[model samples]
Target: SAMFRDYLSRFSLNPKQKFKTLSRGMKMKLGLAAALSHDAKLLLLDEPTSGLDPVMRDEILDILRDYITAENKTVFFSTHITTDLERIADYIVYIFKGRIIYSGLKDELLEKYCIIRGGEDDLLKIDRNILIGCRKHYGGFEAMIDIESIGGLPSGVVTEKVTLDDIMIFMNRKGENSCF
Candidate 1:
């Protein structure tokens, strides 16, 4: 707690005095680092990085990294923001509406799901089974599918790489009236 107070004091007028005044970023960093310092065997965090500025997010993630490196320690977290996962997670588990849609090594998801872009006609030519999800573009469709199944797509379309964020968007899309 003293370390936190020390860090918190940096932004305050009274350097030696303690007060309940700290910037959002500073509070987030201090809280996360302190939590890790408590020596918890398992940490369950939900969107811990949400709304933090990029630099502070990175700093907190570094602390998380150090904690996870300790013997018998584990970190389980959930976030819609994918960039953080790319930086910190060894594996990815995708969930939607409380259902576990996918769970595997991070590398495997990156290797498997890819974006295939093509006109409506060309998209019709691809194998249906290969398409996990899709988003409609202005004049074409961008599909998510297994990379090896690129051969199954029509020749006219271009297969571009995608991020976990793209896959999440497709997975989370609900048809009309699904929302209340």
Candidate 2:
């Protein structure tokens, strides 16, 4: 919080002389708000939201939407902004060491993986091949599955909806420490 306080202080806002300051709707606001909205058609952002407040994050998203959806520009931002990604990213390409690992649409990513949870005995009953990655809990095992082979999962293991973040974590873990 202090870091944010320090950052905000850099702006030096004066409550008294409000007229001296530019309006929020001014072009400077648009530019500073969307630094990526320059002549470059493609934007390559890295950790753009790592230190932003929630309100600022939303504001940045607004700026991005204005550029991408309204202005018809292309963005190539790399972020852990899963919430933002769900709303904006049309395609995601997982990269490591300049190599591409997976590239596809966001919706397809959610559809491909699922979380299966059950007791160890219940897990033993299910086909091992269905499991992609697993984490042992106090009472049960939570597993990520690429359930393409079977028509449906086993009775003991219930399939739960997986988010994009879940799939990304599963893929990263499955790919060892090298996935990007």
Best-fitting candidate, scored by TM-score: 1
Clashes of 2: 0
lDDT (tens digit, per residue) of candidate 1 on 81-180: 7998988898898888889877999878887768777887886677666676766767778777777777755789887777888778756653321111
Model 1: colliding residue pairs: none
TM-score each candidate.
0.77, 0.71
- Name model 1 segments beyond 4 Å from true: 1-19, 70-72, 174-180
Per-model C-alpha lDDT, please?
Answer: 0.72, 0.64
Quote the positional error of residue 30 for candidate 2 in Å.
7.9
**Against the true structure, candidate 1 has what lDDT?**
0.72
Candidate 2, residues 62-100, lDDT tens digits: the string is: 767766886678878887778888877888886745788
